[model samples]
Target chain A: MTVQKVWSLFDRSQLYECYECSKCSGSCPVTLAGDFLGPRKILLKCLQHGSGRVIRDPLLWYCTTCQVCQDRCPQEINIPELLTGLRNKAAKIGNIPERVKFTVEKIAKTGRSVLGFKVERERKRYNLPPVVEISKEEISKILAETGFFKDLKIDH
Target chain B: MALRYAFFPGCVIPAKYPHFESATRAIAKVLDMELVDLPFSCCPPTSNMKLVHYDSWLALAARNLCVAEEQELDILTTCTGCVSTLKEANYIMRQKPNRRRKINRILEKAGRHYEGTIEVFHLLDVLYDHIGLEAIEEKCIYDLNMKVASHYGCHLFRPSYIMYPEFLSPSHSYVPTSIDEITEVLGGEPVKYMRRFLCCGYPLGANVDEDASYEILREKLYYIKAAHAELIAVACASCFEQFELGQVMIKKKYKETYKLPTLYISQLIGLAMGIDNETLGLKEHIHKIKKLLPRLQERTGRMRATL
Candidate 1:
């Protein structure tokens, strides 16, 4: 996707509403953790350099989507939502992190994020009722129809 | 009347923390809350799946909602993340007609439809609002006299417009008191601590940037420790895991031992309700909670002597 196409996915008015107040960055847990670029800088960078720069930045993945920045924003800018949109765009171009890819693959295959023999064994050991079987065919159908498999290039 | 809900255990609890499920089940039985099981997929956790493909996440979450709607029951989730994803999907499908239409088209492939009829609830909401504090207090067989630092996980109340529309005027999202109040009712003193509203960094720590995740965890642990909290109580499964396992990771990496035990709110409730530790899965925790057992037993002993 081109920078303009990526930029169009977000609300330009809301993006422009940011006044560089930096409260988002100041209150951001990831920013406070010391290496992240934070919301304020990310918004400024995306506006100036376009979504391409922000999408490719490794720091983009560092956001935990905690929404603290959005909650604290005086402008009510939804930074986490914006980051998610960008990540979706990035994912289309196959720019997702390896670990994220693995997780998505697992979900696609198992209809759940984490599943293994040990989990079943633990359930039995605890005397808990067996977990109901998810319809894997339905899950894959949904993923396929939504282009999740296409975007991530997972084998359906 | 007994409240019935389609129990959404989510992915994490059943796979990694069966104890949370067992504890919730035990408490539900005592409270007359009936949790019905259904074939459900992941809530399509917002941290990654939503980030990967928004529509796919919505479709998957909508499928779960559809299953509940078909059964004519609201969803009751043990995990805060599951509640966030499913509730947000329900909210969006209700607010945006076009998005719903598009997602329904996707769901057609899976033979499912989201009617937006059912609501999603976290276990804390049901216990506090539906079950009521007085009922819970009356049911307690033993006093939970320990000092607790209640960790209200972020997903419980963030994005206040969706999670808590009623409190939009003077948002309680930042300073949620339900867990604290619940703690108080159970006879545990909810200690005041800095960084109580902060994220547990499990989302970041579990998936990406382990170092940064540890940094956030360290910050949260420092404040809880400063308050001299006896244990940390959490409603979200992920937060429970983070507090329990994250401390061990912190100790290994930084050589600093906080040794704070973490308990799910359900387990804590079960303890006060006089449920056995084995049934509550207390021994399964990574952090040995043998210290807490003695403290609880001692309190029960004292109460018995007075009687």
Candidate 2:
């Protein structure tokens, strides 16, 4: 099967460990705002529906990545991490908002995510502190050490 | 003494922000942790994740983790965004062996695989666990009285598996005291705040709602102002950008004002180490944390007077 079929085999089981404690919902900053984004419900969606629905739902992005859900979850579920997975799953299903995609593209091309703010120009705003660049040779050496080349199956 | 791993510097710090890397490097060296700049690419490029084509992002992040695991020393990243992405990919890959295997196969083209051999470490954990505060304290030349507001950023504190143990407190203002202690060692007070540990409006970067985003910053500044924070310090580079830039937006939009600057934990530690302003890149800040420079020296003079 293709990658989609393989990913279909996994979902909510990988997402959280809610014992029905409702702390995730209770502690959620967004939930306090009267949204449907309570951690408990998200967990339930992922657990019951797996990535089938949880991944693509806009309710997923409402998460602030606030550790409140994780902190309050008695099960110690990695809520934000799970949120990321679900978000990733949704994105796979074409659930992404347009602006987010553009941000991602910009980051991929230039290694800087936001568009058009040449840092060299604005360094004065929050005057940059002394920065050290990771030299190409250094990155090459890192690739060699991590066996990163072999693991990624790259020629470099 | 030679520790190496794939380094994912992420978008914020590597290009526009450099002090974070410089300071992390300094602390890593003193702690004897050698960081290697890895050949990994961006973690799905933020908003680029296909609401439609998601595997590409997961696969992309997995490719980076696979490279690190292949290297055998674990992957190390400085940006909160990068750390969260790589760690999450490693988690997903580990959970689904077949998925991990598939991604590994893709990485095989790049000569990497997620065999679960490589782990991920945020620079904070690296410093806390490996370097230890005792080692860091030995290097401090001046104690600080800097009253700071600590922003842990959402990515670092959540997913407690990767974060330190102290952050589980529900009512806790500041998440960790180690950074506060670092400021104290340099004579700056790491002032605690009601919402000191809250989000830094960074999650809004990928999302386009600037007004909604401004609310987050404005909300945060409300507490920062109430707490009388001299400077707001951050561990995450994206957060550093949010505060440094967000304040400018806030000043323009709300017609309210905040002149405080954000400091990288590394930048402050560099100061405590007596590394000097120019060496620490103090001049390039948008809000210019230059005023605090004199305070650092004033503390030094105070110490001399006491002596």
Give the top-scoring candidate (lDDT).
Answer: 1
Please give the TM-score that candidate 2 achieves against the real structure.
0.74
What is the per-residue lDDT of model 1 for residues B1-307, given as tens digits with 9 covering 90 to 100?
Answer: 8999999999989998898898899889888889999999988899989888888888898999999999999999999899999889999899989888988988877777778788899999999899999988777777777899989899888888889888675533455788899989888899999889989898887667878888898999999999999899999988887888889889999999999989999999988888888878988887867787656532333221110
Off by over 4 Å in 1: A1-9, B169-174, B297-307
By summed lDDT, the worst window of 10 consecutive residues in model 2 chain A runs over A130-139
Model 2 Cα lDDT, one tens digit per residue, B1-307: 5667666677667566655666666656555666766556566443344222345556667766665665677777777667766776666677777666666665565555556777777776666666677777666666655788778777665555544434545543225565666666556777777756666655654463455566767878888888899898787877887888889998898888988888888887777776656546777788887777666543333221110
> Candidate 2, B187: how far from true, in Å?
3.2
Q: Write the per-residue lDDT of candidate 1 for residues A1-156, one digit (tens) a residue.
A: 112144444676788898888988898888878767888888898889878777877667887778988888888887877888888888877778889889888888888997767887888877899999988888888878877777777777
Query: How far is A70's C-alpha from truth in model 2 (Å)?
Result: 4.1
- Give the per-residue lDDT of model 2 (tens digit) for A6-66: 1353344545445787877876655544445667887777667765766656766665556
Q: Tell me how far the alpha carbon of residue B298 in candidate 1 is from the true structure, in angstroms, after superposition.
A: 8.7
Question: DockQ for model 1?
Answer: 0.65
